[model samples]
Target: MTEQKRYAILPLIAIGLVGGLLSGLFGIGGGVIIVPALVLLLVMPQRLAAGTSVAAILPAAVVGAISYAVQGNVDWTAGILLAVGIVIGSQVGALLLSKLPVGFLQWLFLGFLLVVIVSLWFVVPQRDSEISITVLTGAMLAVTGFLTGILSGLIGVGGGIIVVPVLMFFFGANDLVAKGTSLVMMIPGSLSGTLANWRRKNVDLRAAAAVGLAASAASPLGTIIAGTLAPSMSNILFSIFLVLIFTQMLVRLIRAKKN
Candidate 1:
């Protein structure tokens, strides 16, 4: 008898559960987990994995964002402004994904995470500070969103990692509010990116659905947990999470190079 393997949903579900939990707790789109898992565990191509991951983030982001909104942590004006820029930027990124060398993306991802982790230790956000919506600030927020969206499309991220830190560190927003608003910004960003990926035949709907449903189901639990943690502790834990991911990817890259 010959042993053969085909598609299975179990791994996808397992990946989704972990990804969703972290997404809610850290206010990220879970692409950090999904993209690598798809590429390493499922033997997916990097570009395709990124595209599928973006598609999956849509549903999970919606669920997580609503949970945060229920706690009154979301900023509608700031989020909307960010979304407008993200909508246009996602298309630009999606276009770039096909043209740019995939190796460059790995470096970009690793570098950005390092910068964010370092930035977190120096910044402590107050829970009471909210976004002061001035015209200049709004324009800055939109520009921030546009740049983040481009990276999101290229990397299959939901933009929360960058957005959350930028909101808390630069905008003087509360940690929770930054998280909630980042989730909200991801909704349109993911949708727009997913559409572009779909047109490029980069997305696999079956895989996306499997991962997304599992992630959405688990997301609220993470949101509930996030509310119980202190902002300082949350930043510490998030930094640890990023470190682990960074290490994992580095190890994988080393192994790939050795092969």
Candidate 2:
């Protein structure tokens, strides 16, 4: 590689490493980190950054998912069912994105996040033993997946925030399992989305590749730590994470309005 290219690639790797850590720690796809880093550090446009971020998420998801699976935290059937629904719902979300007003969607998302935050904060999380995959459970997971996918397509997030809480509250999954299942569900959708972005020439392939490789290497460490944390602690941490995300999004939306 050229000298300048090597220097540029270093930052992308750093971004990926951090994103990967968050991904493993919280079951996110890490676009939240990748998108902003590409935009600010690489001076990429927002659309291109979003597309490239999707590509960067692929490896992190894979590594994190495997790590969680090894720890017995992943529910394969739930993840698969969610993935199927996400694929279908993403298309609907993309269609809705253009039809809905920007402010309306932004408000809606923020409100939903707020509700989730409140729910996670106050509710006593379910025990791990309570988790089971019945037909009805699978159906509920699919519905959650659809909502997750719609939010992903509409707001460009991985929807782990939504998924984790839903799994914990409604499906009786523990925090680690909820995070793991969410990570597993992200793999297929991220791959598909990345390919679409590549087809549209929206990805910075070189930078994204660097990010993905580095993220894959670092993600397992995060999963290890997450597995060790107390369930109550994990729930609190997850709730706090959602608050930060919500605050950032809300600020950005307000600034956009002022502009």
Candidate 3:
């Protein structure tokens, strides 16, 4: 590679490493970190940055999911139910995106996050023995996943941000289990999105490789830390994460309005 190209690769890897840590720690796809870092640090265009972020997310999801699964935190049936809903919801969401006003969607997403924060603080269920899934529980998970997928498609954010809270607060899952299940639910969605981006030639293969590999290496460490946190502490961390994501969306919306 040229000297300039070589220099560029290091920062991508660094961004991916940090993003992956956050992903494993929080059961996210790390697009929150990857997209902004690519735009600001690598001077990538927003569209391409988003596409590349999707590509990088796939490996991070896989690595993180495996770590969570190894700990017996993943609920496979729940994850599958959520994934099924995501597939349906995402198709509808993509169809709707072009017709919706960006500002409106941004406000809506912010509102959703606020509601989630309230639920996390006030409505989160007290810890008890792990709940076994029934038909109703599976249905609830599917509905929550569908809603999360719609928002993810419309806003270009990872569905995990929505999935984790719903799993915990609405479905009565413990924090670690919720996060792990969210990671499992994200795998197929991320892969599908990334593959579509690749087909469109939107993904930069070299950059994606550097980011994905770095994320894979760092994910286990983050998962380890997450596994060790208390349930209440994990909920606190997740609420803070939601607020941060909400603020970012608000800022981006304001910027778009200006231009």
**Model 2 C-alpha lDDT per residue in residues 1-259, reported as the tens digit of each score:** 1222322878888998998898999888887777767777878766667666767777888999999998888888889999987776665555554455546876888898788888876775645444688888888889888877777655556667678778887888888888888888887767656565555555567777898888888899889888887777776787787788788777878888999
lDDT by residue for model 3 over 1-259, one digit each (tens)?
Answer: 1222332878998998998898899898887788878887888765567667766877888999999999888889999999888766655554455456546866877898899876776654454525479989888878877876666555555688778777776677777777788888877776665555555545576787789889988888889999888766777777888888778777877888899
Once fitted onto the true fold, the runs of candidate 3 whose alpha carbons sit more than 4 angstroms away are 1-7, 91-101, 123-132
154-258: candidate 1 lDDT, tens digit per residue: 888888988998998889999889989999999999999999998987787788989998999888998999999998899899899989988987787777779
Please report how far candidate 3 places residue 27 from its true position, in Å.
Answer: 0.8
C-alpha positional error of residue 29 in candidate 3 after TM-score superposition, expressed in Å: 0.9
Clashes per candidate (backbone, < 3 Å) = 0, 0, 0
What TM-score goes with each of the models? Answer: 0.93, 0.88, 0.86
- Model 2 alpha-carbon drift over 4 Å, by segment: 1-7, 92-103
Cα-based lDDT for every prediction: 0.89, 0.76, 0.75
Pairs with steric clashes in candidate 3 = none
Candidate of highest lDDT: 1
In what order do the candidates fall by TM-score, top score first? 1, 2, 3
